[model samples]
Target chain A: MTARIATITSGKGGVGKTTATANLGVALASAGFRVVCIDGDIGLRNLDVVMGLENRIVYDLVDIIEGRCKLRQALIKDKRLSDLYLIPAAQTRDKTAVSPQDMIRVVKDLKPDFDWVLIDSPAGIERGFRNAVAPADLVLIVTNPEVSAVRDADRIIGLVEAEEKGPPKLIVNRVKPEMVKRGDMLSTGDILDVLAIELIGVVPEDEIVTVATNQGSPAALDPRSRAGKAFREIARRMNGEDVPFESLESKDGFFGRISRMVRPGGA
Target chain B: MNSGLAVKGVGESLLIHVPAGPWDEVLASLLQTVVDGGEFFHGAKLGLQLEDRELGAADLGRLRDQLAERGVNLWAVLATAQGTRSAAADLGLALDMGRPSQRAMQPDEPIETELPGDAAVLVRRTLRSGHHVHFAGHVVVLGDVNPGAEIIAGGDVIVWGRLRGVVHAGAGGDQDSVVCALDLAPTQLRIAGQIAVSPERRGAAQPEMARLRDGQLVAEKWIDEHRR
Candidate 1:
């Protein structure tokens, strides 16, 4: 199977790129696709903890890229999904330890067997970000509803476009329905109007996501989590399934519309 | 086949030296070069030097249409062929590059002054956070200037789209310089020695210009009163 390399990047930190990458890998694998998630944040390794594979990583991405071990030996298989895998990053080395060409060669080796290769990009538009997107067939930019987050997402989108990786799809994470209903937060429409890209998923804010993350299990594996459900739909969309988006705004939809009309223009 | 296309920056526009050969092959390679180049050709005016290559009106029209689709304006056509020259005339294109003295040998060199007095730099894309656009001349942006970004210009600053970032216009201590944007909501505005923050927006977005009025920075609607 030819793997589609999708890099999840956010120009700002703490925007849930790792969570989305882990969840997408789980959801895609749950759907019977062979998925491998690579934590591109080398020094700040966390995908292993999010995927519950931290203890099993004997050889990290640096090891494999540095030719210390075979590609198969470094892949830590997920306990829940037989087909899902985790290629954790080195915790000690900085982003300089790996290069874009190294990522391309490593991804090339993993391409023959996997259906999907998801990369968790680090924050900032620097060497780490470049390493993640170098081998990507598609890019998924993750951003929150805040102005700061959306602004960084715009920067990341520009860089991705500059790299000629095609237009990256957006995943707006941590939307609070209540806040949106109360006219206190930026709506999906507002973000879309600014970014002007295709929306693949909109994950609502849920405390269970934090709980699930701390538990070392992706929420996408849980049947009851709302954010998990959003990620599952993202995975389905990645698999070429036409799943309708869940309504994140209040049912009235009137408050959101009025807020858009009266929102401050410049400042 | 790929040698048929030579794309380079000349002053503010791009000059393409179109080599003579099979039209189809050269056209394919030319299109490929622009597409693969990425983010460089957007909003750029193109001058094609088609030497000794005769072309019909329809063929010239097709070329113009293709370049236009990619946000490139075909401003001039330099051709020695008489038929190609007339076809270009029918299309309202300039035949000569006009003195050719303004042609910059190095792409990234500061633009030689062409305006009556002031020099300017044109940026065609959004400058996101962490982006710092520093220029010695006036600056013009066709896209948004998001927060956390900074634009330092030696002269006036103009943004066709939103301007929410910090801008230091007239950085060379010219207090007479001005800053204009479609949406003037900069986090902080600096003109020479003066500094001011944008007042909170009250209503819908409108073009606004900021300048030093009696030693104080004021932003007003870009109307007939504020004509450049």
Candidate 2:
């Protein structure tokens, strides 16, 4: 099967790029597609821990690229999902250890074997970001519903377009519905207006995501998690399924009542 | 021998004029010249002037990588070929020197009747954050200018869509130059030596024009005479 490579990148740190990569890998694998998630963060490798495959890693991305190990030796299969696998980044090596050409070469080898290859890009539009994006067929830009994050996202989008890898899709993560209802947070509409990109998924703020991360398990494995459902919907959309976006607005909350009174028409 | 190649310093960067020739020979000679220059070429930012020499993205990317390995940074590409310009732009290289030392037209200089019009550059796409446009003449953008983007012009500046970025018109001290946009809310606006920040927008946005008035910068509603 020819794999479709998608890179998950966020220009700012701590905005859920690794989380999105892990969860999407699980969601896609569980849907019966063979998937491999590569952590492109090199020195700050965390996709392994997030995917609960830290203990099973024998070799890493750098090992494979440097010809120290075979590609099969570096792929750590996920314990929860039969078809999910991960190529963790080298903890001791920096981003300079791997070049953009190395990433493209490695991805070319993996394309013929897997159905999907998800790369977890590092923050900033530097070497690591370029390494991740060089091999991507699609780019998923992750950002929070804040001014700084959106600003960085816009910069990343510009860089992606400059590379001619556009138009990358956007995923607004950790959105607080209540804050949006109170007019305190930037809505999806506001972000789309500025960035002017297609919206892929809107993962609302969920406490279960934090809990799952702490346990070294992705929230997508939990069927009851709201973020998990959102990720599944995103996976379906990726596969060309026409799933309607789930409403994040709470219909019965206090802020919702105030908003309803203020607008009269359903928001 | 560095024949058919000229290197000169422009601001902080080195401007290299590459003569038109076979691609491989031109590239080899270019690299050889850099090698011969030794320490002077190392760690220098280069702006290549390729006159009518077409290049694709792969060729440009390879050249950049090769230069990078030799401790040189390729920051800009000045080319007459449309293909080379687009390729360089796709790689995020500056299309122009950005703030040329000489103005396109000096205010006190006598105008020539042979000249058809004032020199200007027209941009047809949205200018996202981190994108910068600097021209010695008038500037016109057919799309929105997002925040963090910047435009500096020697004369009037006009944006058909929203203008939310930093902009400076009349950079050569032409106070008569004006900046107008459909939505004239800029992060910061400057005309000649004066500067102004947009105030909190009230109500819906409307077309506005800003210019220097009595040595102060002010913005007013822009109304078309025919429509009015």
Candidate 3:
């Protein structure tokens, strides 16, 4: 099957682009799709660590691009999932080592074998970001529910538009539902109003995400994890599944307590 | 492809040798094309070489207004038409067959004018985050100025959309300059050398104008009476 290259980018740093890419890669692979996750953040690679495949990486993206290693050798198969693979970025080389056209050719070569090619874009509107988005059939802009993150997302979206890769879908991550209810944080609606883009997913704030990240096992592996489930739903949506957005606003302690108290049984 | 009607740069002004053609259509199309490319002709000094179309005051005045709407000034009209020359003189615009005098060209020179002032450039696109516009005159944007975007104007700024970006009106130390937008909330606003953070919007946003008042910046609902 032909692969759909999806690039996940955020202009601001530390907003969970790597985590999202790792989780989405795991989710899609578990669903019986051949997925390849590429860390587009040259000199600052982290997707290999996030996916727990850093030790297995004998060759990297730069090696393959430079003809030092075969494409097959550069790809490290996932320990947990056989179908999932990662072409880790070269930590020694900087963003200048790879160009936009190089990324296009690389992704095009991978298109024949994989079902989905997910690229984790480096933070910033520089050469690295352009390289990540150069071959994207779809672009997912991830942001937190803060004003700063949303503002940076807006800027990235504008640049994406200028590149004619417009109207990219948005995934609002690390949303604190209680804070939103208390009017202390921007709600999903408030963020969407300002950005004016299609919503693909909204992953609520969960402590499991932090624990999973530290363990190098993305939260998408755990069935009990809410954020993991949200990411799986995003993956499904990407695969052309019509999953309604989970009602994240009411699932916090406030509404959970009310629902449990009102309907004691299965209701 | 009309080789006779040469349009080229002469100093700062564009010298257009208007060849014999349908003057109305050619002039209108020329203006439309220039305006379509936003800010291409803003505040530009323009001269026309009208061979012998003895145009009246009404025709010249209409053309002048058209240029004015696009932020271009028709400074001179070189014409063999005596009526056209007279009309240019009536409008206080220059009229001659050859070059502009030193006095006429002085205002157009960057070295002569220490600062470009008052004349604003209007932009009709969203200034997304990280986009920047640095102009020696005023800046007027017809779209949203998202965060991370910046505008440094020598005079004033006006935006028709949300203004959440950094805007420095009167950037060259003209403290009397103001910034007005549909939403007057900016990440930071600077008039001359003073900087101010927009206070939280208590109520719904109305069309607001921000200016330095009483040594502190103030934003009030835009009213026509207070526009001056």
Instruction: Give the best candidate by TM-score.
Output: 2
Candidate 3 iRMSD in angstroms: 1.2
Alpha-carbon shift of residue A224 in model 2 (angstroms)? 1.9
Chain A TM-score relative to the true structure, per candidate: 0.94, 0.93, 0.93
Q: After superposition, how far is residue A265 of candidate 3 from its true place, in Å?
A: 37
Please give me the DockQ of candidate 1 compared with the native complex: 0.28
Q: Which candidate do you rate higher for lDDT, 1 or 3? A: 1
- Report the poorest 10 consecutive residues by lDDT, candidate 1 chain B: B97-106
Candidates, ranked, DockQ: 2, 3, 1
What are the per-residue Cα lDDT tens digits for candidate 2 across A1-267? 999999999899999999999999999999999999999999999999999889998999999999999999998989999999999999999999999999999999999999999999999999999999999989999999998899899899999999999699888999888898788998877787788877788898899999999888999999889898889888887787866565566555432443333233211
DockQ-derived CAPRI band for the predicted complex in model 1: acceptable
User: In model 2, what is the error at residue B78, expressed in angstroms?
Assistant: 32
Chain B TM-score, one value per candidate, order as shown: 0.49, 0.49, 0.49
Q: Which is the leading candidate under lDDT?
A: 2
Query: For residues A1-267, could you state the per-residue lDDT of candidate 1 as single tens digits?
Result: 899999999899998998999999999999999999999999999999998888898999999988899999999999999999999999999999999999999999999999999999999989999999999999999999999899899888878888999989989999887887677999888787677677788898988899999998999989999999999998998777766565555645733453343333311
TM-score of 2: 0.74
Model 2 lDDT at residue B162 = 93
Off by over 4 Å in 2: A250-267, B1-115, B224-228
lDDT of model number 2: 0.88
Candidate order by TM-score, decreasing, is 2, 3, 1
